[model samples]
Target chain A: MKYSGIKVLWEGLRGNMGWKPLWRNPDPKKSYDIIIVGGGGHGLATAYYLAEKFKITNIAVVEKGWLGSGNIGRNTTIIRSNYLLPQNQPFYELSLKLWENLEQELNYNSMVSQRGVLNIFHSDNQRDAFVRRGNAMLMSGADASLLGVNDLKKMVPFLDFQNSRFPIKGGLWQPRGGTVRHDAVAWGYAKEADSRGVDIIENCEATNFLVKNGRCYGIETTKGVIKSKKVGVCVAGSSSQVMGKIGINLPIESHVLQAFVSEGLKPVIPGVITFGAGHFYVSQSNKGGLVFGGDIDGYNSYAQRGNLPVIEDVCEGGVALMPMVGRARLLRIWGGIMDMSMDGSPIIDKTNIKNLYFNGGWCYGGFKATPASGFCYAHLLATGTSHHDAKDFLFNRFEKGRLIDEKGQGNQPNLH
Target chain B: MLIDHPLLGLRDSSEFIYMGDAKLLNRPNWKSKNSKTKFIDYGYLRKNPGGVHKELWYHEQGDRSWLVVTRNTVTHEILKVELARYLKRKENAK
Candidate 1:
């Protein structure tokens, strides 16, 4: 049943009870050509692209829980291509391009809004650095614009621009940066993948991998043993535990990242605004709630909840930037475990084990990289080569000392 | 979370700065063969388990002493806390 305006009109006239379930909930099969562990945004997108682009329909995405139960539904939903490094800029730019046409390509609306993103800079040196970063973004074929204090005052007059510390001087804006409906991405990809004959097995956890010699050929799941020609693991924060079953240690740490939303109010914030001297970044949702988040809890932990100190710190940052935020009643707070990589970047490459791949280590920024992570991981699974855009996100870079450390915080996952 | 400090009775965790896994104190022999690979593994790889973990937390705003805290990552419950120097002395005795 294709969803169109005519279909909607007919359904509206005829009882309006003709809506169907988005995707199938089929039992697990004996084997598949490829098995993607972790049916989050990345896994579902990988399956969707595998069928849509590579013409590979014999794939199964096994999830420990239901769809939209992981970071896909637990993120701040901000998307942007305003990266600085040569390795990260082109990759994120590709993601932004994909986000532009994702709703059309999937025939589902993910609410990819490009309301623009403004990264505030405090000091003159920070402004100079942002100027250089803006040039870098422009060089990578992405749009960028610098705004001074006067322009900022005209745009968002509510900011505490004259604060004693961390005064806002200017900002680097990306006009094409904004938020999206995060869970819709998972559902759309899952529906498309299921429509293309790819099986999505929910509540089936991959307990262990069938490793013989140095190669992986299958997985032992809670359901049963499932054979596969190739396996790709995209289990975000669970990357360490999932790969540790094969005696492989990763340069990834699991830390709890917290985000909060306030009670709905009149529409105020235009787009995403990030504080330069602090870890706070905020945007207003269509529901009029102010959605915001700060840094991770700055420790290694698998708990999906954060401590109170970090919450207090994040709220202080919010109040410091926008004094009006202190008046808004805090509605809700949530946390998701982040796979903080050693260099504050993602990893999408084949592991040492043959025919087995790993695509975790997204740190705190996986939500914005959903499409490209899937596209690149699907390309790797299909052709046995890293996609050109994701070639720098290899696992060997750590051992080879060619790390793409964007933050320059070497080896310390907490600091990154 | 309140971390039970060894020197000071139960104190707020905000007073401490978390460093990382306590195994980092076991720095590999740099003069040995394959020091590069050893250092790379020592510097990068980690066994970030979801169960019991021994980590380094510095009492920056407190007594300014390094302490090893054994805690559960899943529950975020502190099990035991000990001074790092004492633990090092015990390791050197071994």
Candidate 2:
């Protein structure tokens, strides 16, 4: 009877209500304190933070399907605080700290591995840029070390330092940045939130919002109308659609990002390795599979399947870094939808709608920022103001022309 | 559409008179590891505004973009110079 967040998540996953209703709750009608759309990391994290931090237990996190069964579960699971912009660095650092204590805090096994993270530099200009970024990280109380080629070789011995297109150069190393179990994070948060009295509704899609007098009063879902005084649109990819119901057109684009897992082999990659010169990053999952992902699909698509171009690109990048992996068979490759913003950051704030809030536009870096996002959103809800730490990510930045374009690439793909 | 070099933070757009293996532009002297890179020299301006400008751009960084240069169409000279060198003159404060 003590339906906790983890318990409820497990039930929903196991089809406690059964598979049919989990995917298709034909007559969805209900009301609760808050209706969070999309059961991904943002949605689940928002619910967890609202209940645990704000003590607002009447919240209902409605998912189109099972939790973490979307982008939340399909990301590279990288956690780092190496942002050049002052606005993003602190928020991400908070998330990094949260990740360090996640296993204990959530009372769940998230398998958070802070082995380390390396961003290899291939040019002097890149080296200069990363030097500045590393300095910024240190200024913000985060750890970042600039290492030379010898440092890199010592850290990752198996790397093909001798013969490579972009030979081994120094790198920016964050001892704390690493990977976590993507699915476990989603499930852990959902379970913890549910146990804390938050309603974790799965297979219950948020079809629309019920706005009265220009304020969101509740949501119209496949399950029916869920009444609530406040609502949070935590959906990432479907942000435009969900916000459209309330007449808000988010300056967000839906792009596809793909990742692949190689068959289990003896773990070669100790920590997360990212080619500063290429769109590739790899981390060995606890289960021994090498989980790797890189740049967007070059085109937009709601379809979940990936194309050969990115796969080939990612493989080539992988092989270029670690030749041994060239022999490992790719077990499976999948894709997820990312709500890429005009700038490659996130938007977590109260929407133009009075009580409707948002925590979206994570791009490819959602997993790492989940905890910080939830923390800041909860702070906003509890204090009735934007967290001082997150003023840069305001939803109106686009119109205000104050976009925090970190990479200065002026494109979304460069944001991550 | 012409784009900036994918990994290199610069642009040059011209038909690559010749393709050469990339080489890394920077490596600390204290390190013994190989720092190689590659690049293509097209005879046109690759629209990479936030990148370095050079006739020959080694894509030391990844994130495919455009690269522009002045290539001898007849001779197919890959080592051609960039015309933008003259514009380096600082703008006068009128």
Candidate 3:
């Protein structure tokens, strides 16, 4: 009836030791048409898109660990397109579109429930900001509705509507945004792509790039040398280390974010709710637990075990919003490292090196953006161009001083 | 910012206040007349019980919603300002 210490159980099942990744194909022969590094959501999604959309079957998604063992399995799994900035607005909307039809598209039950998401405004200024965002969503053809306190009362009756210091002014509601099974998103793509000739080489760690005449031709993995025409780097949190092997420095900071689930209850919350005042976001799982998470561990950390401050901060938000959850008890909390960019958005484009494509920097939204990200990353790999609208998220954007700074924090996840 | 309420404890703050007449935010596509002008505010500053800031808040974004903005016990700045004008002023001065 509880999943509190599931992390330890997960490590035991996968035979994962401290600091080593699980599900890695430790003894893989490194020769394929395409070699993808890092088997997280981004990499797996890339492989799925390469096979499903581009018809490029001669691919090998080389993962150092088992699939979805990285940040893919660690996120709180809330998906929404209620961003205010223009650069992120369309891109996130595209991801929402993918989530809408993902069950039909992947032919796998991801359990993606469109339970609606709400961003509550606690101040006149916050209300004004939501107004701008709501207007932007309306203009961009997104399904957003600004809700009143009465509407919120009708939706969530137990909410402390009037008595709190920060009263509920109103909320920006996105009817289509909700949660999904995070691991299922990864396994769904892996199962589908694996069935379609994509060599999901688990336990294979790509250590170095075999560059010939200043162009990448193949990768030298820990297992053996794999010959490939083009190599796509879909590693998420460990992207910088993987790219460093190829002499590329990304402005990516590896920060750890922890997610906590409460002991199973008889489903109190019907939909996902994010605190506008804080970074806390929560959604009830089908298994009856309250899944929640907050901001990253402010500093860079390779260690997956998070610190104490964020835990306290997130728990405080939970208790303040839903006081009844205080008695439910904390079941388990786990940490995953995210390759948080200076900006909160992701980067999906070709590097300056020919044949070396990159897809990283998914800041907490990687799970929601999995399908569209992989689809676009595949298109970028095959045609050397973006599929939908990811040209702004190029690595060159950092050099050109054109950062897509979401959260308006300006390229710093710590600030966000 | 301590304000007593039946639900919110001692330190609740409010977000913004609509001193003037404003419209309540609504769902544009909803097929009901009560979609927009649905609620009215109680024209008083309460402690904004929202976790981050401590200030009085008003939902004048086409919706007459009210909030208690919990701000710092010392520097009384509304923790998260949503009003574009106030935020723009603060940001522009910087």
Per-residue CA lDDT of model 1 for A1-416, tens digit only, reads 46789888999999898999888898888989999999999999999999999999999999999986999999999999998999999999999999999998888888999999999999999999999999999999999999999999999999999999888999999999999999999998998999999999999999999989988899999999999999999999899999999889999989999999999999899999998988999999989999999989988888888988888888999999999999999899999999999898899999889999999999999999999999999999999999999999988888888888877988888877
lDDT of 2 by residue, A132-155 (tens): 999999999999999998887777
lDDT string, candidate 3, B46-93, tens digits: 111112333334544324434443333223333433443454467568
Error of 1 at A388 (Å): 0.6
Off by over 4 Å in 1: none
- Per-prediction fnat: 0.94, 0.00, 0.00
Which scores better on TM-score, 1 or 2? 1
Q: Write the per-residue lDDT of candidate 1 for residues B58-94, one digit (tens) a residue.
A: 9999899999999999999999999999999999999
Q: How close to the true structure is residue B29 of candidate 3, measured as C-alpha lDDT?
A: 40
Candidate of highest TM-score? 1
lDDT of 3 at A335: 83
Sorted into a CAPRI-style docking class, model 2 comes out as: incorrect
List DockQ for all candidates.
0.89, 0.02, 0.02
Candidate 1 local lDDT, residue A113: 94
**lDDT (tens digit, per residue) of candidate 3 on A286-314:** 99999999887654455676757678889
**How does each model score on lDDT?**
0.93, 0.71, 0.71
Cα displacement (angstroms), candidate 3, residue B41, comes to 51
**Number of the top DockQ candidate:** 1
